[model samples]
Target: MSATTRPSWTWTIEPPDGWLVVPSTATEPADAVRAWESEVVEALLESFLPEGATGPDAPDPDADHVATVRGSLTQTVGSLVTFADEAATEGARAMAGVGLLDRGPVPVLVTVGMGDPDESDDVFMTVLGAKGGNPVSPPSIEYPDLPDGDGIKVSRVDIDEATGGAWVSVAAGRRTEFPDGVVDTALVWRSQDLVLVPTILDAIVDLLPAVKIIRSTV
Candidate 1:
């Protein structure tokens, strides 16, 4: 396996540009992927908890539930076991990093989890959709740009009514041919606050049609 594997990326939106893309290279691909999973879960829990509700000094059951959910999401993503060669590893490296795109007070947390097809299948579900007997309700939002398949899924969760903050996540799958077989790719986005849900949704819808993935041997 290549020691420093990284994938190239192309964005769909420009005016809404300036997303600071970060590659997960702090450690090996597998370790990096795990680290990202932990961070994403933390961000999610932060979004769900009431404002000023958490502190290292206090214990909260709600916070515990959020933590459990994070673990679940990580396990779900990690369960992808049959992805294309090195794709998971390489893509995970591409998934790391943060970009702050401010649209007035609403904050958008953009996450990338593309891994090499030759590696592991962990991040595959995020884009290519998941394979199993599990079923989820259809999304309230329509993503016309997303291709239909088990690899792509979208949903919205209303977290807090008092503050009106909601969470929206998009798992888009892409396919690229490799010498071994066809490989899949995926990306995820989570909104920080209530006022930003619609904005994030719109941005994702507009950006989906423009995302491009390519496999290289050079």
Candidate 2:
């Protein structure tokens, strides 16, 4: 399909202050991703640097800590990109957006997609099933009130031993059938601070209603 006539989806949420949202759609430009990475790197340094550190006393770009942070961020971004590509290969139209938390330098990822109902259900079930044998708690399901459609949300958290962190994953789908397929969305938050995960999940849930499916045509 030509760029002008291809249909695309987008979210319409107004993110809270201190949050930066970067578009990761299939059509998003490479330069935009690089710019986002730069912004995130700066935010992370500012958050981790000593309170009074500045100017000549700042950490060197070649320092181990700086490199570690950059490497981690690169891996996170790369994983999300690969995921979106895989979703497309499954006959789904998918796009992802990255949310950067300035103070904690935390990363939040949200993905929206549309595909056959059976295929989408199978994919969601696979994710839920993978959590079965782990020590993490079981996934929770809830019906959310949405403006335009009936909504169902499933959420779970997985503990990461290597980093002593946790990843909270939420998959919310609205029963809105389009000419092409059904609409679904997923949100993921990664953090080492267990105390903050609940607050972040609450914010994610509040924003779920703002997700809208948009179809574009020239």
| Best prediction by lDDT | 2
Off by over 4 Å in 2: 1-16, 23-32, 43-103, 117-120, 125-137, 157-175, 190-193, 209-211
* lDDT score at residue 209, model 1, on the 0-100 scale: 36
TM-score of each: 0.36, 0.54
Q: Write the per-residue lDDT of candidate 1 for residues 1-218, one digit (tens) a residue.
A: 47686444433222235332232333337576567556655654455456655567445766776567566645533432212122335434222212324331122223243345577664454332243222344444333444522234454443455775654454444454444554444455544444554545455444443444444543
Pairs clashing in candidate 2? none
Tens digits of per-residue lDDT for model 2, 1-218: 77658555654545555554544546468787667656666655555555534355666654666667667766665555555455445433333333434333444455565668666366644443323535387777777787766666666777777885676665555556666667666555544555665566566666565555667665
lDDT of 1: 0.42
Residue 179 displacement in candidate 2 (angstroms): 5.5
Residue range with the least summed lDDT across 10 consecutive positions in model 2: 93-102
Worst 10 residues of 1 by lDDT: 79-88
